[model samples]
Target: MRFPHVRRGKAEEPPGIVGVARVDLRTKVLVRRLEPGDIAVIDHADLDRVSADELIACRVAAVVNAAKSVTGRYPNLGPRLLLEAGIPLIDDVGAEVLSRIADGATVRLDKDVLYNARDQVLAKGVLMTEETLDAAMEDANAGVPTQIDSFAANTLEFLRRERDMLTHGIDVPRLTTRMLDKHVLVVVRGYRYREDLRALRPYIREYRPVLLAVDAGADALLEAGYRPHVIIGDMDSVSDEALQVGAELVVHAYPDGRAPGMGRLRGLGLDGVSLPAPGTSEDVALLVADACGASLIAVVGTHWTLEEFLDKGRPGMASTFLTHLRVGSKLVNARGVHQLYQSRISGWALAALMIAAAVTIGVAIAYSPTGPILGNWISATWHTFAYWFTGLFK
Candidate 1:
């Protein structure tokens, strides 16, 4: 093994940010391989907040996108996050860049230009900064009305198509892990999931809610020292180790009954039941909890706001919105649970009760026939302890 400080007469690096180039057409799949100081070359257009957050977490030195990072589509939060994180973003570098640059190749990102290890120029594109991001956001803000209209149309279409399921809840598969009358915690690796999970630790410990992990959210639960009762998703992002942790896997399928996840599970010699649904995995998980007769459904790392809905970059968010309405009073955001759900026994009350008990015991000891004997025993014990403590110094 080589140590950094032990190396002698090392050559000076190139003039710009130098790192290995990790390229992929799918941003989400690509993020898993990303390591610190690696340059991420993706073909993502109008990158969403979740994908951007993943890239930021990977600590990629720079991001080179084949498509526009913000195509003025509802003010995408990805580019802004990357900029804020001080990760250099080269926008709209074109698809040729993906083909030209091989994965694992050492590349240098100098301003807007990308160069190979041999210092050969590969591609050049606009380097996004605060000014460019702001301008693009301004244009995106102007286009929000059009996006909102489109979103509304999609929502109505979804509601019309899934009217039966939304009205009466989706047909949930029978499982050994019962959720009836119990608080079910549905976890998704979305907005503020880590922070929200940290906040919900007390609630989780107190209630011992049924932990239901959605895809990669299973890994999150495992990281937080939790084992999910059931795992639901398309089975694309979750780790194999998480799948083998004795959790029941429910693969979310398309409305037409095409379950892609089953193929993956079968390939791994694992068994899972399929639940054909219309919306995203997050939506399906919520519906499952509601349909399973859960008393309360607490969600962690799930979207709640209009901005979060837009940030998802999916038309199926309409289904999520409808799912919340269907779940009604049963659905509660885990973030707010701490404020809403208060324990019956408070620390102050318990402390006061203990103090009262002590006072009553003291009074009884003073009035009782054996009170003098008890008092003498207590006083002698205290005197012995005090003497032993002081004698240590001598």
Candidate 2:
């Protein structure tokens, strides 16, 4: 359904507006007028930071992007899933687009296109989709639309077939390490997963997962008040403090048998072992947990697509090549910890609330503040508190 464009300054929304869904940013920034109920659609500076799978699982119906997603500048998963799910999308809604939108402004997608399950363009024009992306790129690359679609369809089909074979109860060759049976928490380096991690604190603390870091993830996990049992990967992104934190370090080596990260491990006075497989640090991590017989492996900020791989600008993914081989059914992408676990007020929150309430009540009785402005501010604060509390249930 097309949302009627709300001309700036209009308080009344036309029927076209289905309600504002929050915009997330990545390549560009959009600051639109919005209200509390609006979706916080966003794009991160790093595409991998945006969790498309979780977003879909939560079932947002529309998105406005501030980046050139289907423009060949980045991966297609974000736009691809939106289109497939029939979510309306507008691309390149950068800073300019944001400035025009106000909090609670009904966001209208004047141009949204869609594609069907068969990869056929059901609708086209203003919205972003792989078809639009392919056509624009194909035109420049001198390839026909049909040919590109054929290749992509075949590729998607093959991926599905392979996933079925690999994940559907079969055993294959895998890397071995003994930490597999531990409650493993895999960390990815310097991403926007901080909020996700913070929200996951209850689970992490309650379960006490074996904290495993892949380079920078070691530093991140440490900062979050967690200790690393093992730090895996190239050892480049990890901090010296983290290296010194007493976690065992293992260097990942290339297939040619060169362990480049070994030197870094040595410099940190840590002994290392080489896992010469092909993939990202995350890929080898899965192998490590699986090989080690991890009872359950949970991944935070893990990459799941070619777009993410390409966005990293790596040549190939050899380490990840056999990862599905090792941890086929043992993996869990714990992106939405907020959804998986309920936050109980517990005795702590309740006790803290009582103390705060007593202070607020005592101050109000003593001061008897009378200014309308101050009263309004207090009301807004309460309203905002109520909004966030509702999100916990949502």
Candidate 3:
């Protein structure tokens, strides 16, 4: 997709750029309710690629951000992605615009200026373009060293706080799911999650592994026709239908036992056990699988690389790093498994082979010397059964 180079202070009008505005402080939550042709108004700063992808999937006509899409902290790829997808992006519109504009109100965009029905200007923001994005990316790249230093410091602090849990595996929540001596598949809604799951279809069918989903990954599993045996996460992104699918719910809470998600469960009239730990939900899911003594754990779409961690804007990747260390031997990346494993013979092929074998056996028997003896035996048995049947009816 190609985007026009937008010059700053240019007053050129974009053709037919009008739609209902959908406002939300939380981009992720807003994305769930977003519909195609609607203008997304969000307060997200330095929006990540994943969120951008979700918004793109929703097919929003445009995005208006209250905060800077690229703050020069690091090269966040979200704004660039949206622009490249041919979606209009207006940045630094200020948070006050969210309060002034009501949700589902029709708004028109004339270049960078947003107006209500009366043509009154509500907000003005800078239109992002290829030149500006490239410049911002260069600045962001120059700032990576400082970000890395901050990341290291945060990781060290996380390691210090989570040492006991990592080393001893103490305080891991007990689960009723029998993971011991059985394969456990942990699905996370991360990069290429749907593609990874599609590739692992053979593995899923052959092993019949215990399906464990983290947040929206539960919906992914359901879409793939597999019911999650256990659902682990903060319960924010997952749908209510997924929660009511009868899977065991495990809520990830703070170390101090503050579970913000518990209220949602209570509101849903659902029961869940709290797992207090300091880490991402995916990390907690891995820990749960290891703690439950899974023979092998296959992970799908979990972030691994430093860039991926940074893309997620998660400063506590030290916990994920430590969790991997604890579950070292058993954990296997599903992406690797998809590449290496051989495809098993499908059920239809096996059935066809069995039918072919049966036909061959029948042809051989018909031409064999013992064919006459076999026919005589069959005739005698039928006659005897017929006589018995006639006597019973009489």
**Evaluated with lDDT, which candidate comes out highest?**
1
Which of the predicted structures, 2 or 3, would earn the higher lDDT when compared with the native?
A: 3
* Candidate ranking (TM-score, best to worst): 1, 3, 2
Ranked by lDDT from best down, the candidates are 1, 3, 2
The TM-scores of all predictions, comma-separated, are 0.83, 0.48, 0.81
lDDT of 2: 0.58
Off by over 4 Å in 2: 1-180, 305-307, 318-322, 339-349, 352-394
Clashes of 3: 0
User: Where does model 1 exceed 4 Å of error?
Assistant: 1-12, 336-394
* Model 3: per-residue Cα lDDT over 1-394, one tens digit each: 1113346966444444788889999887798789998999999888888789888989999999989999888998898889889998999999899999999888887689888866678899999999989998999999889988988898888888778888777466667789998999999877667778988888788999999999988988998888999999999989899999999999999878999889999999999999888898988999888888889999987887777777777687767877887898998888665566656998899999999998997787789999888878878999999999999989
The alpha-carbon lDDT assigned to residue 365 of candidate 2 equals 60
Q: Where's the lowest-lDDT run of ten residues in candidate 2?
A: 25-34
Q: Model-by-model lDDT, in order?
A: 0.89, 0.58, 0.86
